[model samples]
Target: MHARTTTITADPNRIDAGIADVRDNVMPAVSGIDGYVGLSMLCDRSSGRCIVTTAWQNEQAMAATREAVLRMREHATEEFGAETPEVREWEIAAMHRLHPAGDDSCARVTWSRVDPATIDEVLDVFRTDLIPRMDEMPGFCSLSLMLDRQTGDNSLTAVYADRPSMDASRQRAMYIRDEFRRGLHMSAIDVAEFDLVLHHLRVPELV
Candidate 1:
């Protein structure tokens, strides 16, 4: 599967309107396009940062919708009273679900970079080492890893049942993340937590 993410920094007060536009407008339009799979939205209300991801059956399908999505993105940006958004395309490298996310679920997202040549090895480690550990965390719901093959840029998101569970796991989560970083020689770029406001992504389990 392939995915495209649009990151927007919006006016904190207008986030609700922005989200409504995506949930009501953008989603339905994208759903009717060929090869459409699913869409998810994550929001950090305090910072007014939102990330919207749309999944497609393949790279071609994702590419084909660029123009259509461009317009929708512009509208969303306006609705949020935001600055220009940053966009990226990626391959869905791995996905695992222990349970479905609920309305109160929260997610922690980590963006990192690895040597392009080492991506396969990194993925192997993620599947064999990281996943099992994450699965055992209290309230763990799901995890998805997305990658930019040529650039070796990747993002991993782990969802928890709710804010309290997510908060309680922070220390252990940091330890595990640090361990993974050292073991794989990966460079950490950024890490943020968000309320999983929209979680309709239906990409099949891809461990």
Candidate 2:
């Protein structure tokens, strides 16, 4: 799968207004996407930055939806203001589902590379060695990889159970940081904390 993420800075007090605008105005096209799996908008009121994540089946499909995405951004900025948002694209390498609420849990992930490299061996190490270790962490809920089509910066997101799970098991995820370099890849440029909500379409109506 693939995803597009945007980080935009806006006035803290007006965030709720911004979020409401997106829900009312920007979500219509989301329901129309071909490979669109899900979309999430995350915010940190103190940090003044909000993140928007859209997941798709492939890079090409994500590319095809660019016009729609750009339109959403323009609509968002009109309400949130005219600041340029930091943009990043991603490819979803893997995904694991979370149990529905009132049953077990609710957290999920989407990841991509932070370093830009097209070498075959680099990807091999990521898929073979690096990603598996993420799955082994305690309370690890799910995994997904994203690669930007333009810059090639990969972002890896691992979702977990709750505050306790993320706090306790994060280091285990960090252990593989050195391995990326051992594969002659660049070190992580930056990593961000993300809160995710995952949805799957091809499922049975167990209720």
Candidate 3:
């Protein structure tokens, strides 16, 4: 699968309204498009940072919708009164969910870089050593890893049942995160927490 993400840093107070616009307006318009699979949104209210991602069945589908998607992104930025957003495209390297998220669910995303030459080896380690350990964490909901194969850049998002559970599992989650970083010889670029703003997709499970 392929995905496109638009990241906007907007007015903190208006984040929810922006999310609503996407949920109630933008999504409905695009959900029926050819090859559209799913859409997810994440918001950090305190920082006014929001990330919206839409998934497609193939690169061609994603490419075909680029112009329309860009317009939607611009509309979102305008609605949120935010600066221009940053956009990216990626391949869905991995995805697994134990359950669907409830309203209280939250997520953490880590952006990093790995050696391009050893990407496959890194992915194997992630599946075998990291995911299983993460699954044991309390409140764990799901995890998806996205990759920019050309640049060796990657982003991983892990969902938790609720804010309290996410906070409670912090220490152990950090340990595992650090272990993964060290083992993969990866460089951490950015990490942030977000509320599960909107998740209205019937995306299939991939293990």
Candidate 4:
């Protein structure tokens, strides 16, 4: 599977309107397009940062929607009262879900980098080592890892039942993250937590 993510820094007050537009407008339009799979949106209200992602059956499918989706993306940005957005394409590397996310769920997203040549090894470690640990975390809902193979840039999003559960798992999560980073020689670029405002992404389990 392939995915595209559009990151926008919106006017904090306009977030709700932006989200509503995505849910009621953008989603319906995108769903009718060929090869459409699923869509998800994450928001950090305090920072007015939102990430909207759409998954496609393949790279070609994703590419084909670029022009068509552009107008909608621009409209979303305008609805949010945000400036230009940042966009990226990724390969769905791995996905595992213990349960579907609920309205109260939240997600922690981490962006990191690894040598492109080590991509396969990194994925192996993620599947064999990281996933099992995450599965045991309190209130875990799901996790998805997306990779930009050529650039070796990757993003991992882990969802929890609620804010409290996500908070409770922080210490252990950090420990596991540290160990994984050290073992894989991965370099962290950024990390942020957000409310999982829209969780309809229906990408199949890929682990």
Cα lDDT tens digits, model 2, 179-199, are: 555455464566556434223
lDDT, candidates in the order shown: 0.96, 0.60, 0.88, 0.95
Which has the greatest lDDT? 1
User: Per-residue lDDT for 88-115 in model 1, tens only?
Assistant: 9999999999999999999999999999
All candidates' TM-scores? 0.99, 0.73, 0.97, 0.99
lDDT of 3 by residue, 1-207 (tens): 889899999898788779888998889988979999989899998889999999999899999998877677888898888999999999998887887888999999999999888789878987888788888888999888899988899999999999998999888888888889898899999989999978864556654
As a whole number from 0 to 100, the lDDT of residue 124 in candidate 1 is 96
Q: In what order do the candidates fall by TM-score, top score first?
A: 1, 4, 3, 2
Q: Relative to the unseen true structure, what is the C-alpha lDDT of residue 23 in candidate 4, on a scale of 0 to 100?
A: 100
**Candidate 2 RMSD computed on C-alpha atoms after optimal superposition onto the true structure:** 5.0
Where is model 1 more than 4 Å wrong at Cα?
none
Evaluated against the true structure, the overall lDDT of model 4 is 0.95
